[model samples]
Target: MESMLIEKSVQGDVESFEKLIVKYNRYVYNIAFRMMGNEEDAKDMSQETLIKAFKAIGQFKMESNFSTWLYRITINVCKDELRKRKETVLSYDAPLNEDEVTLKDTLKDETYNPLLIYEKLELRSSIENALNQLSEDSKSVVILKDIMGYSYEEIGAILEIPIGTVRSRLNRSRTTLKNILQIQLSEN
Candidate 1:
């Protein structure tokens, strides 16, 4: 079914492309948010990714995973924006107007205890702060692998790097994140 859509989309069918947008826009937005650290930038980057995808749909290889290709476009867009802007670290406690629950929420346990909740929120903030400290290369690897659950092979494809490089980046990023979190904990 999706192959048919991809085929039509490649043939310059607007409707088919719109269908593809409906299917993958949220994934693109999630990647954008992880990369950009704010809803507004994520929204804008997601739109830009879709536009780029639409323009390049004809060049998409049918044998490849469509989601991976879309993710690649999204990552590239975010990387470009991050490069131009240099720095942006937004708070996670900001208002959420939509009903879409993110991966962060899913990983968290549903706890009613106030102290546990507070600690969890604080830890989350520290982790995000740690993530922000990582270089773009490491941050993308960690986000794609740990947060987004992309396999190493898939991450390599999405980031257009070798799988070995992806593994090393993820390993190094994880170690750095752990060290950062440890220091934060010691300070508190």
Candidate 2:
């Protein structure tokens, strides 16, 4: 079905292109949101990514899955946006603060204690802060592999790096994150 959509889209079928956008919009937006660490920028980046994909559909080779191709585009769009903004650190807490629903509500545990929830939230905040401290390259690798659960090869393809490089960067990122977390805990 995806292949059919891609074929039609490549043939200049507007409806087919729209269908592809509808199918992958959320995935693209999530990647942008995670990379940008804000909703508005994420939405803009996602829209730009889809527009680029639509325009360049003909150039897309069938060697990769459409989703992977889309991911590559999304990453590039984000990198460009980041460069334009000249911003390195991002606040992952922005979206959470704007949401009406609480994490406890989402967890939906009958035995959920407010104190425990507070502790969890604190830990999550610490983790996000640590993540923001990483360099863009390390942060992207960590988010793709650890947060988004992409395979090393898939991340390699997305980031245009070797699989070994992906593994090594991920290891270093994880170590940095762990150290940051430890320091945060000890300080608390």
Candidate 3:
């Protein structure tokens, strides 16, 4: 189905392209949100990414998956946006709004203890804070690998670097994150 949509969109079918956009819209927006850390900026970047992808569809070789190419475009768009607003960091907070119930609430009958759940959530928030301290390059590599679960080769293609470079970046980023995590742990 995705292949057919890509083919039809490439063949100038507007509806097909629109369908593809709708299908991947949330996925794109999530990546942008992780990179930008704001809903408005994420929406703007996501729109820009789709527009750029549509404009460049003719050049897409299909040597890799369409989603991979689209993800690469999304990452590039986020990088460009990050460049203009370098070194900005978001203050990490527990997602404790009414719409977002605590992990304890979600774990109703689970075997996991409530204290453990709270601790894990706090740890996750701390990791996110440490991530905010990283350089954009390191943050991008970490998010693409650890959060989004992209393989090293895919990351290389997306970042337009060699797989070895991606591996090294991931290693360095993880090391930095681990050190930060340790500091946070000791301080707590």
RMSD of 2: 8.7
Worst 10 residues of 1 by lDDT: 89-98
Candidate 2 lDDT trough over 10 residues, lowest sum: 90-99
Model 3 Cα displacement at 130 (Å)?
2.1
Which is better, 1 or 3, measured by TM-score?
1
The lDDT values for all models are: 0.78, 0.78, 0.76
TM-score of each: 0.78, 0.77, 0.74
List the RMSD of every prediction in angstroms.
9.6, 8.7, 8.8
lDDT of 2 by residue, 1-188 (tens): 77788899998898999987787798899888877877898899999999999989999888877888898899889888787878745333222222344344545663555435447888888887777666567678888888889999999998889999998888877876656555555455
Candidate 3 lDDT over residue span 1-188, tens digit each: 87687788877888888887887788788888777777899899999999888878878886787777888899889888788876554222222122433344555675665445447888888887777666667878888898888899888887889999998888877876656655555455
Clashes of 2: 0
* lDDT assessment of candidate 1: 0.78
Q: Write the per-residue lDDT of candidate 1 for residues 1-188, one digit (tens) a residue.
A: 89899889888899988987796787889888888877999899999999889889889998889999999999888888888877743223232233444333444565544234447878888888778766667778889988889899999999989999888878877876666555555455
